[model samples]
Target: MYKLMASLLLGTSLTCAAAAAPANAKPYEHVLLISVDGLHAVDLANYVANHPQSTMASLQKTGVFYPNAVTTNPSDSFPGLVAQVTGGTPAVTGVYYDDSFDRSYFAADSKCQGNPGIEVNFAESIDIDDTRLDAGGTPGKPMTQIDPAKLPRMLVKGECKPVFPHDFVRVNNVFEVVHQHGGRTAWSDKHPAYEWLNGPSGTGVDDLYALEQDSLIPGSKVKTTGSFKAEREFDAAHVKAVINEIKGFDSTGANKQPVPALFGLNLQAVSVGQKLPKAGPGDDAGLIGGYADANGMPNSGLAVQLDFVDHALGELVGALHDSKLDDTTLVVIASKHGQSPIDPSKFQPTDEDPYTKMPGYAFHIADDASLIWLKPEERAKALTAATEYLKDQGKALGIGQLLTSNQVALAYQDPASDTRAPDFIVTVNPGVVYTGGKKIAEHGGSNANDRNVALLLSNPSIPPRTITALVQTTQVAPTVLQALGYDPKELQAVQKEATQALPGTPF
Candidate 1:
């Protein structure tokens, strides 16, 4: 009888406190974080200004819109996504680029012996254990490269590990925070490896549907000696999974009980065939079998992808409405990175050139843009050849830009330490794109066109307004945490001083 009386008194006091609170006092109960891999802010602006049928434009009419959301440097998908979810920079998260070098390990037979493989899992690599220590061994005698066949064994033997996002991110993500607070979580995306963005253990989310089976490949599709479809059916399957989860919430009274408090979905069909249609001299067009005709013009593909994503969102929103939880749910639509132009007819591959002969060298184009790989001993010579090549290519392509080894080092130079950067970095003039001989649109570098992406927030509590703040992807995680009423002080203390709160959110 005494216990019951105490419980009743506590419930009454809680009710009184809630009633006395201000109208804007209720913290958001659910947060939805969506990442469109290559959606551009400029493209969103154009859609809002002109495309009346755009779903994004419709959301903008009801939410806080930011037209100048930029990503951190290196602007690759892994780093961009990591920043968005962690509210941290590459300096803190260590996701510098898609392809980078690890000095600890070296391949006995390969020239690029110490380079780390793509798809780094930051959290797993950075723990107290030295999972990501250079492959060759330590910082001084790191392994230069691993034999392709030995990759699995190395991972099993714990000899080599992914760097950057996999090894570098040191903290829990916003989703994890929500989960810790008793909320369920789920995420769906084209790149399953993205699960690592949160951590190696896939913390925060209880369910994940990585649409592609293997994300290490350049394109998120299975390659059967080259012939492949740009759009994988698995994308649709993931959407179905999302729908099923939402439906399950309704059937089980999960929302009223303990449904997913946070969720995310990624749609990838639009960015699938990003390459140009034709192959040029010395290009790897034949390696992937002659290119297939693009399903539609690049712009058309984007529109379709957007529409498809919208349809899925519409379904999810409908589920929320039916569940009677619309008012408490906060939905965000954002992008990891933006796309660049792709015109394959201009590609020219040359083996006679020493720069082109370097490891990982694909083609030497005329746009101050060329892909080359160099050894540590050859770094100086490669830099000279790259600068001269850029001068000549700049005049030919009408874009005066050069990316030498010095420039590459300067771009990625650790503000805290002096370390050698990528052997060769492609610096392109405005409007020039690198196909990597794939003929599809791609983004893995730092450029205004590649770094700028979209950001939208919609919820009942937020007053509709357009914001033009210089928001970075790194701000997303902290913003989400703040919206959920989590103590963001810990995250803020570790983040850069410029960390931003979500615009128009009552925190």
Candidate 2:
């Protein structure tokens, strides 16, 4: 009778816990995630080491800092964020680049200057509709943005209409999962194109405040906050949006709602500041050198940017405290990709288009990563010629390793049957940005430095720890779900692709 009672009690407790579920299990009721583009883990650690009183230093005091987080090998924003959010790689996610090549597409609207065809360069420019009108009414504002019809779109193979963001992604994002379970979601990002962040969800953000960070169009501003160049003030607007989300009102004094389950925004200042020329139009040449660094150190401009980001974090922290949500909210500071080579002197500019030199070749080239898409008939010839050419001029061209598409696909279990897969991925030597320009650093390679990023998960309730384990950004999805008391198995990519949560998570 005693054993029977004990078993009954145990079963009762387990039943109650299952019924209570997320309400009783989760340490955090909300998650605030933000990505800092092109930031490396070493950079953040270096900043913290040098600036003991900095904003990052304060967070580092209580946060679990991962200074050796692994990003996707491609290391571009599109694939990088997908990995972080969905825990799916290029093979499963099928997202190669933000502006990537797709042969499966038949032109819907046909952005081609000539005749429309099956090939399309799917870029961010076409993601938003024409509602984006500049201040002068010329157009290109993300505020009134919708889906555009004029841009080249990948129709549903046989369908003549274009595909939406939801259809483009192969898996569901955290937003849809959380929202489905009665959680509110909100996000603010660089371009309206980032609407893709909603992932596989036909529905867009419940509260979206997209800022045209680099809009050339005049008057194309986020009425809530206007920013120039690198979204200095736009970042402030995101902070405001988050506060508003907690309070239940968007920037537009309408649609009062409940606190969002997930809310955050990306910061562009650091990337822009790091790349900003030391001198403005009238600044002294001596001062110009102060903004840029030879070895990716935090120079004057980058330091200013770092401080600015810290200030933003402080502001957000203060707001969360003011709202009394700090204890219940988990703040994440993550990077989409790390800039390479931290030593900027390694750049080898491609003075001319290398693709043009290859005779008898029909191919499309994404010069940034040296990705070459070859026609089926010309693939063998192109591959041979390209191989010989790179071999002959390896040192001069900065070809670190040129792997065939088959190798990449085979290694990742991705078949080259997909049009999104490139014929050959050219891995340039460290710091070699093949494109000719003033850019000192570039990513989009398999270089470890390019794929190494930082992740900071901070909550006052959790003990501070620094994990040096080999954690990939893909683990972020499952980790996030697990933190929220959602079964990591619910994530399609996690379940289907077998992406595990972060190894050192407190939960």
Candidate 3:
């Protein structure tokens, strides 16, 4: 009873004398967090300015904008999203990439044994066998570079367990923070594995919905850019889930559900659109691919995506207004990461696998550099050789700078301290797009173009203004706490790291 009383007080009113909610007590009863993957602040500014009637434009006029918001380093969706949910960097959260190697974790075959180490790819792959992490395309349409055999995977403790999205993360998220305090939560994203956002409680979202777009779907329908029509259609289920959840009903056909205190979904349409090739007949032109102009301005493909996201936002806003929840709900629109090498001429691909040729070291290469894990016996020797080899390769290998094992440990965390910390971090130049597969433009680096994403938060009470001061997505977690009336310290990561609430927010 004491806990319930506290929840009521912190969530709504300050009236201690009476249990009744004051007439103006409710400033915000619901918080909606949305992420548009691969969206840049510049894209938001550009799209809104050009598409004035769009939901984003409307948000610009009334919502607080972060013109200089940046995502966590490595700028991959996994690490980037972890920063938003956990309020910390890779050091604080133990998250660096979706497909990263862990020195302490052994392969499934060697689980719990005196296993050396293993590579772990935390994606939709962990969900089910033959999960088809890259399945799409219509019967006659072209196909993407989906090779099931090539998809990254690893068994854990000699068993195949699904790596829930939050499994690798080392801290709590807003969902768990709110749920434990008597608040309801819901979320939807690209894969069932996204169940990770639920935080450490392992049940952060009360009404969780996830879909695997990369999974194979049988039909004449093919995917567009980042996903197929069917994929976007699946994500729509998440949008509908939020609407229903707001009405006190379960999105999974259960009724009599309570309104969620926090809820949101990812709109992948923009990401897919940004990567979508101008549909055509030759040069794999029929296939959906993302390419940019020399100046990095998006062509029609990305424009379509921007409009789609805005339209989805408008629909959700309309739903809120229809339910009379608009005035009481807080709307947040942001991105998991930003797409990079925006200039068309900047995309470059290479297959410089020096580690595979060596005996004691293995590596995962992406975004023009490699994340290397050395054998326990030769850690020092391999580190030196790999660093020197890549350094010598120089622009020929498209290498930029190598963050040595010790340098990374000091900057991120010691591998001895954090097994998730890769031994070395290789960063490529801006125009360099290293690929073993199809994606032309990419992210997952410390560069500004890769990490500069769009972020905006809104409520009826907030006076809209664009903020140019540097802000980190890590600030959103604690900011969410403060906005919801919870003690910012309620978030362990926020408390330990001293993450600040977003500036200019009413809270």
Top candidate, metric TM-score: 3
Ranking by lDDT: 3, 2, 1
- What tens-digit string does per-residue lDDT give for candidate 3 at 183-244? 98887777655656767777787776665656554442343233435445555766777777
Report how far residue 47 has shifted in candidate 3, in Å: 0.8
- Clashing residue pair totals per candidate (backbone < 3 A): 35, 7, 10
The residue-by-residue lDDT of candidate 1 on 27-69, one tens digit each, is 6777778777666776567656676666666667667887767
Q: For this target, which candidate reaches the highest lDDT against the unseen true structure?
A: 3
| After superposition, candidate 1 runs with Cα above 4 Å error | 1-26, 49-54, 105-172, 200-202, 213-233, 248-257, 273-299, 342-412, 415-424, 436-440, 492-498
lDDT agreement of model 1 with the native: 0.50
**Cα lDDT for residue 480, model 2?**
76
Identify the superior model by TM-score, candidate 1 or candidate 2: 2
| Predicted candidate 2 versus true structure: per-residue lDDT over 1-507, tens digit per residue | 563232211111111111111222676888888888767787788878888887788778878998767777577777888777787777678776665555555455454323222333333355343223221121212334644563446545454566554466788888777888888878877666666766776553566666555443344433211222234655666667666776667634356888778878788767655555453332234332122445457666566667778888888887788889888888888988876666555555664356656533334444336665655445556666765765676676677776666665664433246766766667776666655565545666667557778799988876779987656687788777777878766667776667777655566
Q: What is the C-alpha lDDT of each candidate?
A: 0.50, 0.63, 0.66
Error of 3 at 264 (Å): 0.7
